[model samples]
Target: MTGHHLAVGAVLRRGKDILLISDPPDWALPGGSVEPGEPLLTKVTQETGFTSVLPERLLWVARYPAAGVEYEMLGFEVTGVGPHDGSGSWVPLPEAVDRLGRMWFAPIRDPAVAYLTGRARVATLWTWTDLNEAPVTHPHVAPA
Candidate 1:
C-alpha cells in the first residue's frame, strides 16, 4: 500500500430506497474522491445530481487496498435530496443490500445494512484485502 487517497461516499436514502450506480457489473454508491478544501456534501451532490443534500451521519470508514493503492473510504448517511437525474437506480433497501453483498466492496455493504437496520449506533471501521476474491478481515463493531 504505497499510494494513498481519501474518498467519500453517500448512502442516499429516500424513504426505504437506496440510490445505487451500476458501474458495469457491480453496484456502487454515488460518490467520488474528496479534493482539498472541498466539502463532502458537494462531492456527493456533484456525483449523484441531488441538489439538496443533508448528511445525516458518518456511517463507516473502510481501509481498502486495490491496484497497489490504499484507499480511505468514508460512507455517510445522507438525506433531504429531491428527485435524481436518472444517473443511478433507486432500489429498495433489502434489494440494495443483496446487490451490495454480491459486489466486491464489502465496506459499502456491511455499514449500509447495519446503519439502516438500526444495528449500528456508531461508525465502524472495515479493512479489506486487495484481492477481489478474498474476504474482508477483522471487521470492527461499535460497542452498545
Candidate 2:
C-alpha cells in the first residue's frame, strides 16, 4: 500500500465548468502525482497537453478518507489553449470519462478544484510527475 502522496492540479475554469474526470470506479478533478524535485510546469504540460500549462502555488491541500492519503498539491489555472502536438484535445470535465479512459491509480480531487469550481464534487485527470531535482516555484509557476 502507498503512504503519503503529493501532486499538482489545475483549478481549471473554462467558462463555468472546471475540468474533471467522471469515469467511475474512481472519479476526481484532473491532476497527477508530483515526483520529488520536478518542476510543476513541465509535469502538467506533459500530462494535460495544455500548451498553456503554468505552475502556481497554494490553491490547497487534500486528504482522502479511503486510504487516508494526504497530499500537498499545487494548482495552476490554464489561461489559454493551443493545438496538442500529436495527442488530443483538452477534455471538458463532464466528458472526461467518454473521452479519456480511466486512470490506473486512484484519482485525486484537489481542494483547489472544488473551491474554484464552486461545487462539492469534482474529478481529475490521471498522471504522475517526473523526478524533480529543481526546487518548486519557478518564475512561471508562482501564483500571479
Which segments of candidate 1 are over 4 A away from where they belong?
A: 1-3, 114-119, 129-144
- Whole-model lDDT for model 1 versus the true structure? 0.74
lDDT (tens digit, per residue) of candidate 1 on 1-144: 597888887888778898888866888788878876888667778767777678888878878787888888888888747876766889999898778767765666666666666666556676766545433433445422
Candidate 2 structure, TM-score to reference: 0.47
What is the C-alpha RMSD, rounded to one decimal, of candidate 1? 3.7
Candidate 2, residue 79: how far the Cα is off, in Å: 2.8
Candidate 2 total steric clashes: 11
- The 0-to-1 C-alpha lDDT of every candidate, in the order given, reads 0.74, 0.45
Candidate achieving the largest lDDT: 1
Which candidate's TM-score is highest?
A: 1
Q: What is the lDDT of residue 20 in candidate 1?
A: 88
